[model samples]
Target: MHHILFFGDSLTAGYGLKNAKTESLPALVQQKIDADKLPYHVINGGLSGDTSAGGLFRLDYWLNRPIHVFVLELGINDIIRGISPQTTYKNLQAIIDQVKQKYPTVKLALMGMEIPAFVPGSFAAEFRTIFRKLADANQMAFVPFYLAGVAGKPHLNLPDMLHPSAEGYRIIADNVWPVLHGLL
Candidate 1:
């Protein structure tokens, strides 16, 4: 059986939403696995507004599990808070390095986050580059942007416009599932 662990922030947490366990991407991915009769387990390790630094602080707790797949979906909060991109890059690298040291065979997936034009276009270029660089450096699978189709789409987001609605979650699962399935 494959054990997939989702380590992310509000986007993965399904913040300000209901039936999160059933409506979030992690849950949707779980359902897909079940329908396909794939032997797998999905664990939600998301904490709302968690930055890459925060994820590193809690890495030991989640890394304790025998994870076959580890999905890293952080850095958005840090970007929003105007934190340095270098700090974000370092934190992510640390997590990836530690995971590799302990679980050399574990499949690693890095989910990128795009800084919306409205938020500030200056850092978007560098922010987007971080994911690709890390993926290349660590030889891990990479998702271009976690909120690709869901971001900036009013219909797909909740009232807050920050978090995705259930439909949006499906979009996330759609982009993520294929990559994960291939690994499985």
Candidate 2:
């Protein structure tokens, strides 16, 4: 079976849900893979409040496995912490580099995030474009804003409004599926 790793923060982890294994974006995607009879195993590598730098630190562990596809959904945490856009970019680049080095033929994908509306225009603009820049630089598949329609839609999120609810995860899974399917 092919392995597709979904690496990200709490949003990808299905935080606050009663059962992340069944309600998380990765799990939902796995369900789709099964339903469509696709030969792929979805691995959830998300952690609550994980930043790109944090992901870089732990990525080697995940790389120990045979990964055919890697979907990155990081950077938001870094942004939330007021990390420089340049720093976030470097960390994400390092993460991608490690994956490419380990699995030269791996199909890579980037799940983009948008900076909150109130952030400074320059910083917001820079932070927002990191994924596209990375995708273009690495020639990886890209999902522009996985939470597009669901973000800020209070009903779609948990009470914190920072993490997606089960319903929101379902929408994200649908958003990610088309690009992920194309990678196969």
Candidate 3:
């Protein structure tokens, strides 16, 4: 079976959800794989409030597995915490490097995320550019924005408006499925 690893923050982690099996993005993707009868194993490596630095720290554990495809989604918390964009960018690069070294033939899929509108224009613009730059430099498959239509949509979010509801995770799975399927 194909082993696919998903690493990210609360959104990918399905934060606030009582059951990860029913609510998390990896869970939703796994359900799709089963329903479609695809040959794959989906692993969730999300960490709540995890920055790229945290991802860096846990890289060894996840990368040690025989991962065929890796979905990287991080940096939101860093941006929210007002950490330097350059720092976020560097850490992401480090992740890419480590993954490449360990899994030379692995497929990389980047899950992009946008900064909230309330953030200042300059920072938001730069933050948005970070993913694009990384994808370009690493030659990885890019999802543009993970929460495309669901970001500001209240109906799709939980009470905190930060994480997605079950329905919302379906949308994310739908959006990510094609690219992930293509890669595998």
lDDT of each: 0.88, 0.92, 0.90
lDDT of 1 by residue, 1-184 (tens): 8799999998877787789989998899899999999998999999997998999999999888788888899998998898888899999999999888889899999888877656556577788789889999998888988898888899999998889999999988999888888877
Taking every candidate in turn, the Cα RMSD to the unseen true structure, in Å, is 1.4, 0.9, 1.2
Across 1-184, the per-residue lDDT of candidate 2 in tens digits comes to 9999999899888889999999999999999999999999999999999999999999999999999999999999998899999999999999999999999999999999996777767988898888899999999999989898889999999999888899988888888889999998
Error of 3 at 64 (Å): 1.8
How far residue 90's Cα lies from its native spot in candidate 2, in Å, is 0.5
TM-score of 2: 0.97
Count clashing residue pairs per candidate: 0, 0, 0
As for lDDT, the candidate ahead, 2 or 3, is 2
How well does candidate 1 score on lDDT at residue 128?
Answer: 71
Cand. 1 Cα-lDDT:
0.88
Off by over 4 Å in 3: none
Tell me the TM-score of each prediction against the true structure: 0.95, 0.97, 0.95
Q: After superposition, how far is residue 32 of candidate 3 from its true place, in Å?
A: 1.4
lDDT score of residue 106 within candidate 2: 98
Better of 1 and 3 by lDDT: 3
Q: Could you tell me the lDDT of residue 112 within candidate 1?
A: 86
